[model samples]
Target: MKSIVPCLWFSDDNCEAAVNYYVSIFPNSSIESMSYYPDEALDEHFIGKTNKVITAEFILNGQRLMALDGGPVFRFHEAVSFTIECEDQAEIDYYWEKLSHVPAAEQCGWVKDQFGLSWQIVPYNMGSLIQSDAQIQAMMAMKKIIITELENA
Candidate 1:
């Protein structure tokens, strides 16, 4: 087992939505398991409800992700977003197209999906060069490069 794991929180059926979307986005990713509520507790908030995916495990490009029907207490925002390491613009485009389903949420290589989850679709090498200079100009340059790369693709 890995020392730590990522537990994504969702409101109602959003968890299911994310799981399905992720499976479709990554070629090697698939749902490993999904445990729903038993029949006896069907009427409860989540008990016996198929919508409540107790535990859903999947992998995206060799990265394992665990999702749950964690209810509406927490929400997703740009403060926390998943960074996809892409070798080329095609990979970035693939993620961008899949993630940018909502046009209003699109911003500087960042997007908030219909489910409220934030994702940063970026080129892998861009981060290394950006880290070398945390200045505003360097950040802008990196963003420009990413946009240029995506445009060229």
Candidate 2:
């Protein structure tokens, strides 16, 4: 495992959804495990009901991401987004298409999944370029470059 990994909680079939999504995007990615609740249970109330997924894991661009069917108490939002520092526009474009499956989510360089996970797709050195700028015109130029790239797609 890496020093840190992202764990996402979802409701119902969210585990499956996440697996399908990330694996499809990352070239060498694949689902590791998927376990469903058993039909018979220990308790009277638990009988024939789905309780939990034993484990669910997948790899995205060689990064490990985990998911669980832990219900809707927790959710994904823009407040916590995963940023992809892509090498070039092609890399950004590839992620943009794979991650932004939701048609209405293409906005402000951010996109949301059906499960509401927010992701920021950007070029690798874009952030440093913006931070290094001391002049307003320089920042504007950088912004224009990103917008132009996005538009050209």
Candidate 1 lDDT, tens digit per residue, 73-92?
77777788888777777887
Where's the lowest-lDDT run of ten residues in candidate 2? 136-145
Error of 2 at 78 (Å): 1.7
Regions more than 4 Å wrong, model 2: 40-54, 101-108, 131-153
Assess every candidate by TM-score.
0.76, 0.71
**Per-residue lDDT of 60 in model 2:** 79
Taken over the whole model, the C-alpha lDDT of each candidate is 0.68, 0.65
RMSD of each: 4.1, 4.7
Clashes of each: 1, 0
Model 1 residue pairs with clashes: 41-47
